[model samples]
Target: MAAGGRASGRPAKKKGPNKGTGGQKRRSLEGKGATPPAHMRHWFKDKSRSERIAREDRGGTTGAGGRAPARRRSEDAPEYIGGRNPVLEALSAGVPATALYVAQRIDNDDRVRDAIKVATERGVALLEVTRDKLDRLTEGAVHQGVALQIPAYEYAHPDELIDLAHDAGEPPLIVALDGVTDPRNLGAIARSATAFGAHGLLIPSRRSAGVTGGAWKTSAGTLANLRVARAANLTAALREYREAGLFVVGLDGEGTTEIADVQLFTEPLVIVVGSEGRGLSRLVREHCDVVARIPMQAAAESLNAGVAAGVTLYEVARHRRR
Candidate 1:
């Protein structure tokens, strides 16, 4: 009985050459096809030096090389704008975009063909790249399989905006944005300007969003339909509007009168909406003929920049209709 107990379990299978533990065997198996640990895999991936520097900016690991890719100061990189409507609108607006990038395998629908024709007519370059390349260029943005490379947006001068309005017919309704940095907000305002029959959009050259691919997309092609004027100084532009015999109304939450309460259609008007977080710059506020607020529920502190501009535009249109 004692011998049986001591020599139990068929001689313990001879210990198998003391081959470490189960973990070692599992690791060996994993080595065959297992994904590298996250840290190690990141190290082996190819990335540009600028991308590595950007990663460092975000406080991410840059791997063992720690060497960033050389930065090219040239302006050769294409400006990418995603979404169908924005790109279509830009094409329609005759904005000087540099090229159009379509996925090689994208469906050649009628709309897509029309877009291609428009781009070709405008002398914009058309390039077909793999879907992966497109995705990378758009930085995983929702491109809908099409993207456009446009030159940096060229904004018409403030005087040009006024002249455009006058050329269309005097007493123009001009829409201006103050310190709104988001391209989407800018685009939305552009759309509203067109819908409300405004002649042009005036944006300050500094501290304001410029027309870009994202803005063009948000405008749903409205950017192409409306004139955009860039100003050296917003306050100066407002002053120009005043000098041009156009009434300038600034939208602010603290205004004593509501937008609806004010008469906006009797004369040529320029409606200005401020930034999302900050309303208007002090100088911009000082330049307004009247600062009006949109009536809202007490629960609402403020409206989205785009929404506020649209509402003000609607009121102007309503008065014009009357």
Candidate 2:
């Protein structure tokens, strides 16, 4: 056999251009197929001229409701608290978190250990995630190998607050916040409400602070024991409270009655606190049964919304004790 020949000793055939059957023609007889619609076609030039000129602007359209995804994350989204101490403190204070995330192979320190133990005892979800995933979950915060997910707060109706007090066989002393936008102030007021044995909280549905993670943390877990109600209209809710035989008291610096001198403690009450910037709105003041003030040494002196709430709650509790 030749050097590179096949086993049969035949020389290799050289490649050449293909030539088909010399007789019958088959596929050449077929006609051209119909073209698709311009809109359905994928090619740019094949598309309809109108479509090419006026392309759909997908920028402004968000899915069904058309609400921006950022709105979902704004006030109603579940919140995460990162860092070992924050997570541990939240757990220790009975913050009712949904999940406790521990980074994979995290350092087992006292806070992390206690957090895991307490979470386990409280029936909280203990999830193990990678450190990179934990970083994303915590949004680039200093996680320290731990993070806690807190659910969005659920609100109750204002009537439910009254009913809760009724079930407890006590006069309803609910705290109602007006124009207080600070979540921390809301939290501190909640803490004071819990401390002074108030029934629940009533806040305007809009232009007020709803419960948030900061409020939960500032409340020191006291929020769990308190119910919060939202009102579409503060004046309307106050009118309803009046109809239900609850005295509506507005705390204003320029009010006629002083907190110490006011004499309606034993009655069912809804104490309305205004914003730190503006004490009370005109309509809220008009709706209040009695507009009372906290006596300050100097008339110009003012207290924070939280301090004022605490002081007012304390005074109410003291007077009720008499």
Candidate 3:
């Protein structure tokens, strides 16, 4: 026994890296692995380069099928309303919501509190998640501590626009867009249509903006009160309206008839508004029974689809009132 130590003990073995290399071997897990589980991947996430090109080839629109592709979120995905005011307004407007997300430990300000109150009152699922989760949900937009998930808007049949007027014992007054892609413009048009006694709205299933949350908010909740229909082919829809005995009026900057001089305003009509830039597509222009123009002080001036729609609706309403 040497100095009270174990007689059989040799020099103490030195520790070598504690038997593991601080997760170095596990670093492979951090890199890209196999394709993630479908449920874990967000909608439109992890798209391959070819898939992106294919989407572009499709022009980011639904095709001749008259419906968006099955995989597209616009066809079947929860609509997200981000920003405090938009969320709170949507809640107040009784927009049916599937869930309400509040950032964990978010400042309980008036908008946030009101959002929570309305969501709870309406029995929307309230979820408190981390900021990262909210960011992902909003696609990196400013959520301002709250977000709402709503179901996609259910569009009525194009015929339903006429049916509604028939049911009310009045002429059909509908607003149809040619290729307007701005959701805010859709909302504004919705608001104007509702205010001016238009029966419903008609948008093409492709090459047009749908009734998204932004449109809903821009409509100031008027969308809830209006029937919105989608057309497989806008030109075809216009033809159908004509066959159904409703006048198809197209708004263009270079039209032969001015809005004030238009004679079909009081008739059962569908107003077709083209995009601000192109005015009207050639096929869509051919489909119009009368292409009408809004007189402007400056010949070079133009109106966005929303303002043009509002102006046209105003003229229509004026004629109806007379």
Better of 1 and 3 by lDDT: 3
Model 3 Cα shift for residue 316 (angstroms): 1.2
lDDT of 2 by residue, 95-169 (tens): 869999999888799889999999999999999999888877666777898889998878898899999999999
Looking at model 1, the pairs that clash are 49-68, 49-69, 86-217, 89-221, 93-224
User: Which of the numbered candidates is closest to the native, going by highest lDDT?
Assistant: 3
What local lDDT score does residue 117 receive in model 3, on the 0 to 100 scale?
A: 89
List the candidates ranked by TM-score, beginning with the highest. 3, 2, 1
lDDT of 1 at 191: 83
TM-scores for all candidates? 0.71, 0.73, 0.76
Model 3 misplaced regions, further than 4 Å: 1-74, 299-301
Mind giving the per-residue lDDT tens digits that candidate 1 earns over 19-99? 655444656545457777655765555445667667755546545688554333223444677766666766877766888
Model 1 misplacement above 4 A: 1-78, 84-95, 107-114, 117-124
For every candidate in turn, the CA RMSD to the true structure comes to: 12.5, 10.0, 11.2
Query: What shift in Å separates residue 82 of candidate 3 from its native position after superposition?
Result: 1.1
